[model samples]
Target chain A: MTFLPPITAYTCVCAVGRGRDALRAALTGMVGGLTRFDDPVGVLDTFVGRVDGLDAVELPANLTDYDCRNNRLAELTLRQDGFEDRVRAVRDRYGAARIGVVLGTSTSGIASGEDAFLAWSGEGPLQSDFVFEHSQDLYSLSDFVRRRLALGGPSYTISAACASSTKTFIDGAQLIAAGLCDAVVVGGVDTLCETSLRGFNALQLLSPVPCRPNDADRQGISIGEAGGFALLERDEGGSGTALRMIGYGESSDAHHMSSPHPEGLGARLAMTEALEMSGLRGGQIDYVNMHGTGSHLNDRVEDRAIADVLGPAVKCSSTKGWMGHTLGAAGAVEAAIVLTALEAQIAPGNLNLKRPDPEARCRPLMETVPAELRHAMTNNFGFGGNNCCLVFSRDDAR
Target chain B: MRLRVAGISVIGSGMVDWGQAQRILRGAESWDADALTVPTPTILSANERRRVSKLVRLALGAAEAACDSAGLARGAMDCVFTSALGDGAVTQAVMSALRQPGRAVSPTHFHNSVHNAMAGYWSIGSQNHQASTSLAGGQGSFGAALLKAALSLSQSGRPVLLVAADHPFQPPLSGTRPTDGAFAVGAVLTPDVEGAAGPLLDIEGGVNGPASETDTKALHGLWQTCPAARAIPLLEALLNPKTVVLEAGTGYFLSATVSP
Candidate 1:
């Protein structure tokens, strides 16, 4: 984290829209992207941030077996913000074998696996085309991405539930720092699937409506799907406002299997460590993108941690209202949102926030506003108390 | 990207600990059936032990053994755990439920279904607050984990407890793509290469580079057996007088040298 690497280029496709322009417009317009959904997975009265046009999309002919909801989402996003060209340019500079690929996901291609299971129940034994090794294993996403890019360096999938994608940034930065690979292609893709939906529903954590994070009357999460990709480089050709990864901090609560620490102690440690790694003070931060999952404990605990780090005055917001709770994709998705906001020197507001949580000490901005931004931070916490915080600074900050 | 190791601990049907592993690597003994018995962790509470998946048991067992041999406290070590197949049983339970009417997944099953479940349980059980991550690279998971751990230890200047485990899939899934039972391998990588009793290794060059190969062909079963077992051959080369090499990435070889 001391000598941080530059993000250089990034792209995202989520429920909000397909590119950075779409994300910036939605953020500045106070628009929410969540929509009502009949349970594609099961019986659940809830909202989701499901992407459109995935079913009509086709994977490259040679990569037909890699087709799935998750990979489809990744393909949709990879074409955005000139991300593919950026990757190819980096490839030309550093040979395919010198660039590593790391991604994060929770249920990966499980939706395809679910289909295979349903097929088995009907046709007995899955078709050879099912390719369980590629579809079911968490490494499939990384494997698919690596093949798509034709990269031969280090590649793997980090599957730590909600914190997956956020941790990928840490992975990419560390790999570049360690000289494992000159440049690391890092990000994640997660699609709406049966197990994640019904699992949260079974836990009664899904809200019946679009989530309203930091609201006093917030109920629960509205699940969503999205993909975000970033290229982190050690070389110094990128411009200012190019979205550099400056600091990363991660810790586990060792306190819960599925819940946050009552005091957000792990969250606090992660945020504190991120700031410490950045060699910047909390007062120097211009904006904060909170996790703000809208679940009972998540919003409350995360707000407390934010207040502890940035104090009452630092502007902060949760864009989950704009993209829904993207689960594993949220880390990269929200980081993309922060990057868009940073580019415009504006901070996106917390959507659906009418009243603040009474017990909360920090309140997110209710609407987007243009401002000066030098340093920004995004927080992502996952199941098993895996907490991660990333710090990014304007290019001039270097 | 060299990983200078101070100690190692291995668990499988063939090797029980680093002592046995060294003996096998030195060609003093032979690898019979891998009789790995992943114990319920003494570090975890009774309820926590029951709550974790079987894969977690294998990883924790191997991890505890590795840390003990290196005399490194579990809490002091950062971890990078790798596996080819995660907890297949939980995945089976989940997929089966999805096939049913409402797709009612058990919350515990869903939580434990993640690849990092093993690392999560280890963090909670061992109280290691340092950075811990879990990942997979298909059959090359061990190489992926090894290179990462070596560089991390070198950068952080702290001892790292690296481990990899794999248990075969269950049921119809297993019928299609079956693994060779369960096995785990662990290494305590320390930056202190100057004074060490155990063998030392230097990750030398890149693809098609200089490194040693095990002469005893019986040990090569690990390459066909467990994905993490690929590290076993490299571990074996460490005990031998000759330097060793392993395929760290596709078309990229890790040229490693062992100390006398």
Candidate 2:
């Protein structure tokens, strides 16, 4: 009952770069560390990974009807690297009718909106810019991307919290397998905003220090922002370089909304399903991208769940240190990282970790290591117990 | 690629108020019966209900009706929940809290604010461990949800419950009124069994073109109001024999053919 097509091309825009070429370079460690922002929030002192030199530009006159920095960043990210042309050419070749776009994110443009509302009241409508409105709405980013790409196919935006983007991959596959499309573009884009920053800060979840995933003194996640995109097709042959989305699974905990189920019930369900879909046992996976947000609860729950299913033998690491928790962008961004690791044959080191959590149920990767890997899995469990797991295998061999 | 429309249910707002569901069996049989009289309460327990948002409640109501129509227990159905704005009230609340830095985000509101919160609540309420998905497609949320549900049914050899819901805009964002009310709709899909007489449907076509006259006709047959009411159009299309295609505006497309 395979219902998804093979992935065709995958690319991302992060603190690393905008297009595949830049991404490829970043994968090779050519791109150094991103800039750090001065933080008034005490927990996380400075952001480790971030796209440098992204300034607030005047919004297009016609497009200045909304509020949201999230959406603005989305447009800027997609506009970079001639990504639209690459997407358009792919769609044109595949037939626009057969190409679909799916995105994953949370708090699409709330930051801009929240800011706009404040300005409008204090400074007056003349002082308030309409562009702020577009940034605040969650759909702005997806709608903007859809319109910009001129994608006439099924366009969807998934918002399952951190797992949002990972689920995008699965949805794209389903769309292609249903014969609804020939090719589907799936990814996530989220921009750092006061909404997330202040929200996490209020929750006391923001660590003044850089996030340390699987660390004994792990404090909290550093909320970074990024956008990632991948092109998927039903056929692997005759297509350009592409990674096969071998298998994926999703589940919900119905547990506490913000908190994961103590036992990682939903996480386990998604992991098991993904493994079953690949026709591979749990132990077959060589690498795993843990959804380690460096938060107290998330890391512990995920560690227990991974250990319970894949066992301690599976090599897993959290890449949050490299780019912070990109929220919706985490899934696709991390996916790109995994693909990069596969190409480079070396796993990226988990930065900012002092000591491993003594209570961890599974072993965690502390340093960069080379592993000629075949299969890898990335786990993203969002708020409200929504969980998604994606399995990636190299096309040449598997 | 082809799947059957095994079962479907729509719990109108009228039912939620009356505390009794009204079933509208389409085609030759239009029985407006009290939604399968049940002694068990339709709403969740007080403690459980407090934990879920209004959106989840509406979805659960529809899922109950869908599961009943499909002759499956709540535990037997896998679920997929869809919404455009996804509990805007909760989102606004969280934003307000963030605006006031150093204030604690209500753990409850923070949890329900995620896109899949309602879907998670449905899975918990139904006690179903099957795969559950929450998807967003803007105005095309219903179509997207149905597509996922149909695909899940095709992939998993079990009945799937597709719940689509969206609440009215809360304050600060109530400028636009699209239907202006909270609604929940559900449909149960299963693998087409041997010697089945129901409608055999296959969703095809990608996002393309504005709504055509034919698409409008198909949509007209599907439901009355609630433009986002994808389930109605789906049920209507399945019941109507002449119409075979329902293209859901550059989002998703569904086609149905009745066979004996």
Candidate 3:
């Protein structure tokens, strides 16, 4: 497959910080963003990477129908890093009809649905003000973003659990390759809600303290909320520092619904296929961003898969310890982190690690250190055994 | 993009399978409004069979039938699943549980709440490790699925399985989003026509046109209520080849020219 386009601009907002600079400082300082659970939903002892100042967010008068926590986070992120202006420039260059919008979200404004459900008196119908099409529908995220960015091209939302956003890159590229669009706005957004918090609690996957990936006594995951976006267009041969998505691989485990394959067979296949697609050897990969949620099964299986596929010599780490597991947003958030590491020419260390697990095979970075990287890979595995691996490279590398 | 349909399946009220549905479309049989009955998938283990949701049964049942009709290996082809509202029953159950005094959610309900739960079950039952994607485009979900399937086939140069399904929501919640009944459709699309058994489809995106409407009263009712039923016009075109256009999103339509 030929390279489709390069990611010209990207931005993200999470518990760590708002833009690239803020995130860089948090990563370099090894500071985590988890706080005690203070929401009035469930009675679980856990920590969450919650974003600040969402209640005060207000939507435009015309788009009041699309108001929700998810879109609020999307609006906040779009305002940062000048992403909205970049999208408008692309729209002007190609026309609104030529730019597509493809976003990934697991629960698109379902929090509103919960609210409506709670408001019901167990009688006639839901409140008159509740609009399902604009808020609770799975297509709400893409529709809201497309309308907000003023793009008229093909738009859709992917909902494959945690692998949602990473798969958006592949979909965006496919749309461009098919000549359906010239440029695509690809990203993901997920907000904190009672359902996800209580759901993870019921599954026994929430950690009481901040998550510690690759640690000897890691507890579990600290759920997080985030929003991230990237602009992908055909490379016209300009910027040397441009980061291009070289290759991607997706696969399903076919083993279990909630549990990953014990041996990480699907994970290994995704990574190997990505490497093959990029035409890169395992030894050439400078770093790996693992989908380590700090879960015992996830970290152990991923460590084995990374060691077996990318080899134990390559440095790797999971940034989830910094901002917690952002569920659907993890893929895009981690991809942004990978791009930051490449631009800074440094590998970030595991944030909450004290002692590395003795059974782990992969070599994990324990401190932030300077290094030159040409190509890097990031992995995101979701519920129902969905797995996706993406490879990013600098333009100068080719 | 041009492609050939290798297989097709549809399940809904009184529309049991593709064979019966074809007869019904040809005016040989009558449409029934009886509640749709879903069968247990033979591919799943007994343990999994008991755990699967009604939505999963509807989706996997249609997918299995399509692959069987095409004589294609289900495990080898990439799959795309689309739904406007995924598993309304499960969503209501989870939401209701969350409103309880204890606010304790069931693990089973929580795991089944993901929009890709059906895709997960299909992969596990068929043992297909290939790429699988689940998507939602509101009322335009069927068209979006077709567009994605066409693009994926062109990119991979392989056969693709496309499935669209939706189930109704219960009362109070139904007031906000109302779907009449359960509906699902599956088709195997291939770039090459070497082993194709169905009509050739010339699909193009970004076409400015109005969506086609169905004259059949039953089908029109389904089309008005269920998002997945928007495929009726395309399905009618399959029986009698012609050009059909459907809304792909807010401002554009996906036009398909069907040929024998």
Best-matching candidate per TM-score: 3
10 residues in a row with least lDDT, candidate 1 chain A: A234-243
| Cα-based lDDT at residue B107, candidate 3 | 90
> DockQ (C-alpha) of model 2?
0.35
- Shift in Å, residue B72, candidate 3: 0.7
Q: Which residue segments of model 3 deviate by more than 4 Å? A: A39-42, A236-241, B193-196
Please report, as a residue range, the 10-residue window in candidate 3 chain A with the lowest summed lDDT.
Answer: A233-242
Task: Summarize candidate 1's per-residue lDDT along A297-342 as a digit string, tens digits.
Answer: 9998888888888797889988899889898888889889877777
- lDDT tens digits, residue span A1-398, model 2: 68546655566767666655676555444333445656544433545457654567444566556435555556666665565666777776877667777888887776665554444343224133434224544456666667667676777677778888888888788777767777777888887765566556656787767788889998887888888877787676465554577898888777666778888898999999999999888888888989999899999999998998998878888878767899988998888877777666666556666698898977777676878777889999887677889998876643
lDDT of 3 by residue, A1-398 (tens): 55557887888999988988888888888888989998574488899999999888887778889999999998988888888988888788888988888889888898998888787787898788878888878899999999999998888999999999999999888888888888899989988877888899899999888998999889999999999998888654243446888888999999998899999999998999889889999888898999989999999999999999989989899899888988888888998999988888888888888899999998689877788888999999998889999998876643
Candidate 2: regions farther than 4 A off: A1-6, A16-50, A56-68, A79-83, A120-138, A237-242, B13-45, B98-104, B176-179, B195-200, B206-227, B235-253, B256-260
**Between prediction 1 and prediction 2, which has the larger TM-score?**
1
Model 1: per-residue Cα lDDT over B29-90, one tens digit each: 88786566666778888988888776788788888888887777888888898888778788
CAPRI quality of model 2: acceptable
Q: How many residue pairs clash (N, CA or C atoms closer than 3 angstroms) in each of the candidate models, in the order given? A: 6, 25, 0
Q: A140 in model 1: Cα distance from truth in Å?
A: 1.4
User: By the DockQ metric, which is better: model 2 or model 3?
Assistant: 3
> What value of lDDT does candidate 1 attain over all alpha carbons?
0.80
TM-score of each: 0.95, 0.85, 0.98
RMSD of 2: 4.8
* lDDT of each residue in B1-260, candidate 2, tens digit only: 55665556655443342223222323322433223221232546677675665666667777777777667677777777787656767766765665444534666676667777776667666667666777766556676676777767776767777888766555454443333545577777777778533467665554233332323342343233343454444444554544444443344455544442
